[model samples]
Target: MLDLAKLASQIPGISQHFQREMTASRQRLERAQVLIRQTHAKQQDLIELHEQWRDRLIFSTATPVEPLDTRVPITPAPYSHSVFATDGSQISPSHHEIAYCYLINIGRVMLHYGQNLHPLLDSVPEVYYKSEDIYVAKQWGIRVEEWMGYRRTVLESEMLAEMACGWVNPPGPHREPNLALVDGSLVYWFLETLPHDARDRLLPPMQAAWSQLQAAKIPMIGYISASRSLEALNFFRLNACPHPTPNCIVNCSDLLDAQMPCQVVSPLRDVTLWAYLLEPGQRGPLWRSHARILNSYEECHRVYFCYVHVGTEIARVEMPAWVAEDSTLLDQALSLMLAQVYKGYGYPISLSEAHNYAVVKAADRVRFFALLEQEMLKAGLRNVGTSYKEARKRGSIA
Candidate 1:
């Protein structure tokens, strides 16, 4: 029931607005490219400037491990390799449901290339209905869905760790070069907004999972497609800052009404900026993320990332400091990832298959509630009922 005619009528104005924005964006992109080229020649000074202003900046930034403009061609993938990927889906608790509970389903995949062994496609589903399970300090106004999200993250990491550990010590004498892949950023930046108690609860378990992967000597990667991260651009902006004394708050206060010198790069993200510089199957330089959450992580578990240009899209690939520091392992990871992307026709095949297993469809949700209600009734709980709003939704009387 979208009003297509009305939407069509507004297309002219929308097109006009889009044109103006695109024109502005193009100008900013040109200026940013110029700034990047200029800074590349003075890379040492920019690095010094970053080190000097590292403390005063409020936002997360990146430290370049190589020249800012470095573009590495894709390394050749190994003849044989195994990829373990894990993704998760959840059912958010609804007030209209017969019970106050949520479920997390982790879809895991193990794929071996250049081998006759079959791939493993599986899912692990767990339900949480206990009062403690649904509430991570409910008194602080934390919703069940929010708590479940963190729980799912923990569960996904644990599952990935289990797969990685298993890969490290397989039952048979056959083993291929392998890596563990997850579908999002490893940094728990959102944890900064939570209380200390919540942080203590979540961080330790996640770190423990990471420790397991590290102990297994597995290269784990966090892949993000169509990434909008500003870490790289922000780093260049910090270098582009014209103030002699760099104080993000005070030095830029006067320029609030006008465009600041650093704002020249504001229109582009790290991915788009690199797309112009990198050819297909190439990767930009690695960067160390200085997200504040890393303070809670061990030095070995600190996150590093790079932009990879696949034929269809630019992706942000993240890994632990240890993986990035090891040149051999890093090259293996990037090559295997590129091969997977080519197989998937733009995305990683293992991650894509894992997502297929994790996704919870509308029919599945309805069936889940029905089964829950049936079980409750079988247990002699006669008071189970849905909210009036839910009832109306199920049977609309138009």
Candidate 2:
């Protein structure tokens, strides 16, 4: 059994560490606030910020997508519209208990404003066991493909895109101007971290899916709640530097320490920056994401993002440039997003339903194995065994 008493004693020490970290974080937060105060409402400051972002192409940075639209007021959505949201869950292969297999399942829900369909749901599940699909070879050696969760991210994009494919051709009379929502970033942000060969292998499917969604004329969004991304704050950091150059990264780390004029908002996130500026139902202006992987996308499919104040929290919403550029689709998407948030009691109802649809409970996994074992026994094969340690825990004294 665990040592509950000892764990309790360690609480004070943990609390001490947390307090120190908060003190440091607060200082940076203050600096960030000061930076914003100096630059807010200044046209020249925005221009300077833009130039710094564009100049530093070495690292990811955001530039103003519109002349100066960051302060656009919130606009109410149409009275009626349709929304679709998708989410997924997975069961990974484990040598400890289960067979060498993995499963990915997706769930989707569609909602029409002020109306309930008799039924509104979809699901897809796939299992994988092929050797090549189950493992990846790294510089050190081969390991299960699930190690860093790279594959799952690809699967998410692939699933969402695939599910949205049918709508790609043209809008039918039956279809309403619709908004598609996913519970994460529009881009496979992790792909950039993978080795080139691995990245190359995973890129095609995601691209194809996005292409289909774009072609369908659907404005799809990736929603992240309480996000910590600092795209806008990073621009402030660049502007705060006393000595500005094309390559601020080269010496900025050290420079920021000595001439740290921008400590007030040092660690500020984009949502936090926008939070102080936006009213409920308002959204930040669309800014192109600095994610380098987006460069590989077709011109129309490049990723853009905005911060939406959903009453309870600020959320980051990402979409392809094609969606962002379309005024009619963009407004409807924002309106529906806001409505979903309210319906969900501070979350997106369709996404929450999709999550519920795809979740795999532990009892479900046990039943799966039980059924498998029963079939194996009927076929004259021996029962599958748990690991020796697991067996011992289950009363196997022998």
**lDDT comparing candidate 1 with the true structure:** 0.85
List, residue by residue over 285-326, the lDDT tens digit for candidate 1.
Answer: 999998887888899989999999988989999999989999
Tens digits of lDDT, candidate 2, 111-144: 6764454335776776776766676545524356
TM-score of 1: 0.95
On lDDT, the candidate that comes out on top is 1
Off by over 4 Å in 1: 170-174, 254-259
Count of clashes in candidate 1 = 0
Of candidate 1, the 10-residue stretch with the lowest lDDT total is 167-176
C-alpha lDDT of all candidate models, in order: 0.85, 0.70
